[model samples]
Target: MLRSIKARKGWTARAPDEDFAGAAEEWNKWFDADPSARQGAKMPVRIAGMKVPIAMIAEA
Candidate 1:
């Protein structure tokens, strides 16, 4: 199935031939540089019938 659309615009580009460690390192570097990105989005999570923001949960 994947081969059928292999020539598609993003199909080939989406799958990069890089190791997991290398990719994770690159992502960590970007995440560290972007301070605002560290602040988790205001998405709510339901716990014990209470809607809590994800950032609050992350802090704990």
Candidate 2:
């Protein structure tokens, strides 16, 4: 079943015949988008009725 869509932390568009970030045509419509949309998001984790704010950390 298709689930209802909610606001996403980030997004990207890929072409059928193209790999990610290889060609300009596969780019998302918005190139100059805000970086905070992907990086500044806070994930809330609940434990024992306590809510903790967690930040997304990507491995380089």
Candidate 3:
């Protein structure tokens, strides 16, 4: 996800301020964290200034 965020044009290149990597590491420490959060989550129409990847996931 961070890599994808980095690839976007004009997107700022910086570490996530919320400690995403640490959170992910903690979650994975318990179980093989499912990458399926996108399965049912809705994407915002626009995030910051970019059109979100709404079509990437299934709609609720």
Candidate 4:
């Protein structure tokens, strides 16, 4: 599934159990290191009423 998502355009497949906080920190560091890295990048979505995004499910 991760590989499938990775194959798609404009999608990033982060691991389910990945340290999200650490990832955020790392992302911030990367952005700081190179401001151009943030260009055209969208912020991650935070869906309310559910931990995971609605799109994760087969049926919404």
Which candidate ranks first by lDDT, i.e. highest? 4
List runs of model 3 lying over 4 Å from the truth: 1-18, 33-60
| Steric collisions counted per model | 0, 0, 0, 0
Question: Clashes in candidate 2: how many?
Answer: 0
Selected candidate, larger TM-score, 1 vs 2: 1
Model 4 spans > 4 angstroms off: 1-11, 33-60
In model 2, what are the clashing residue pairs, if there are any? Answer: none
The candidate that wins on TM-score is 4
TM-score of each: 0.25, 0.19, 0.26, 0.28
Q: What residue runs in model 1 are displaced by over 4 Å at the alpha carbon?
A: 1-18, 33-60
lDDT of 1 at 34: 34
Off by over 4 Å in 2: 1-8, 12-18, 22-29, 36-60
* Model 3, span 1-60: residue lDDT tens: 432231211111223345445545543443343332422223323357653232233223
lDDT of 2 by residue, 7-28 (tens): 2344333323333334333222
TM-score of 2: 0.19
Give lDDT per model, in order. 0.30, 0.32, 0.33, 0.34
- The 10-residue segment with the lowest total lDDT in model 2: 1-10
lDDT-based ranking? 4, 3, 2, 1
